[model samples]
Target: MKQVKIAGQVVPAIGIGTWHMGDRPAQRETEIAAIQAGISAGARVIDTAEMYGSGRAETLVGAALQPFSRQQLFLISKVLPENASRQRMEASLDASLQRLQTDYLDLYLYHWRGDVPLAETVAELQRLQTTGKIRAWGVSNFDVADLRELWQLPGGDQAAANEDLYHLGSRGLDYAVLPWQAEHDLPLIAYSPIAQGDAWGQQLTTNDTVKQIALTHQATVYQVLLAWVIRQPQVLAIPQTSSVAHMEQNLAAGDLILSPKELAALDQQYPRPTHKERLDII
Candidate 1:
């Protein structure tokens, strides 16, 4: 497994996302199995959110990780945007800790850009750090401007990461966010690195070079897509998978390397759209 360090903490380049694992007994079992399989296969980072089925996901993660030592995992959870106020932030994080069955989270993120003042939220995160409840802190869904605001806050130097959607189809970060992250020594955690399955089938079928590359490596389209994202020096990818086979396949992405010519061909074939448009196809 490839690893990236942020704020002096190390995590796997590809981690398991547990958003869809809540609300059913059978699904919960699958979630636990997938997590166990991921860890056994060398995954260290596990991402969850308080809003995922109203804390059900956190509970599942807590129960699943109980057997493992806290130090062995880089657990991360996000506080909902509505609860961004200092008081609400305190309560939300405490509840998340309780649900996760852990005393401290390796990283805690602000789930969205809510009405609360940025300074207030950053200060509260700093306070959580002082109390040892959170080891590192950062934000999610925050654009470049929002990141600048957070960085200007007191104690914001401890902010470790910025979570966002970045893929072959969505290159929003490449234009601005990526440069900022690299300049500041902040690592960008890429979610939906496979474009939520949009990079398969027709997209790959129409491109002969991508097909030939996959054939040469004996890899699937998903594996090739994930490898492309992680190949970037300052990027880390977290692709969600419930099946053991898929989990293994995703983890193997770090091992596959695309030649510069192949990479350029892919970039040319699937040129990133200039404007920021949220396409449902992904």
Candidate 2:
């Protein structure tokens, strides 16, 4: 299986993403089952956020994790940008931990940049690490400039990872953000890694090259997309799904490797940005 290092621990590159999960009471048990199935399939990272359905996702994750050992999982949750301050950050993390039924998070992320000063948020996150409430802290939806500005802060360089929207169809990070991150030894947590469509409404699954590659590997287009996302070192892909079969398939993608020829073909079809492009966020 492909692996990525984060917070000094190695874990599977493919992880479970809980975005709109746990919002429907009707799908609660199956949602929990899907999570557990993913874990059983050897996915160690569970990415959730306090802001996801106002903590509903974290609650579901907590229940699903009851059957597993805590040390076997790497739990990540995000704090709202509004609460990323000295006064409320700790409280927000506490609530997140409560919902997750854990004493500490493997990683805590600032969901996005907000009105709070970056330095203040970084300092609070650094302080929270000492408090044992969080092991490491990072940012999401950050571009190259944002990362450079963050590294200028006192504790910003200590950020273990950054989560962003990345897929074969969205290669803007290829222009600058990826190089900067690779140089800094920072891992990227790619959300929406198997995106269905580009901004122009072009579907990747319909592309001739993508379809041919899927046939070549006898893998689904989604798996091909995921394989492309984690092709680079220090990158992880978290594709959200509510079905047990799909979760299993997503996890299985970690073992799929694309040839240089296949990769180049996909790149040609979805071509990397020639110039700096605005960071894409969901």
Query: Relative to the unseen true structure, what is the C-alpha lDDT of residue 174 in candidate 2, on a scale of 0 to 100?
Result: 94
lDDT of 1 at 132: 91
Clashes of each: 0, 0
CA shift of 273, model 2, Å: 0.5
Q: Which candidate is the best by TM-score?
A: 2
Give candidate 2's whole-model lDDT: 0.93
Query: Model 1: number of clashes?
Result: 0
Candidate 1 Cα misplacement greater than 4 A, ranges: 199-208, 272-282
Give me the displacement of residue 89 in model 1, in angstroms: 1.0
Stretches of candidate 2 exceeding 4 Å from the true structure: 196-200
lDDT of 2 by residue, 208-240 (tens): 899999898999888888999999999999999
TM-scores of the candidates are 0.92, 0.98
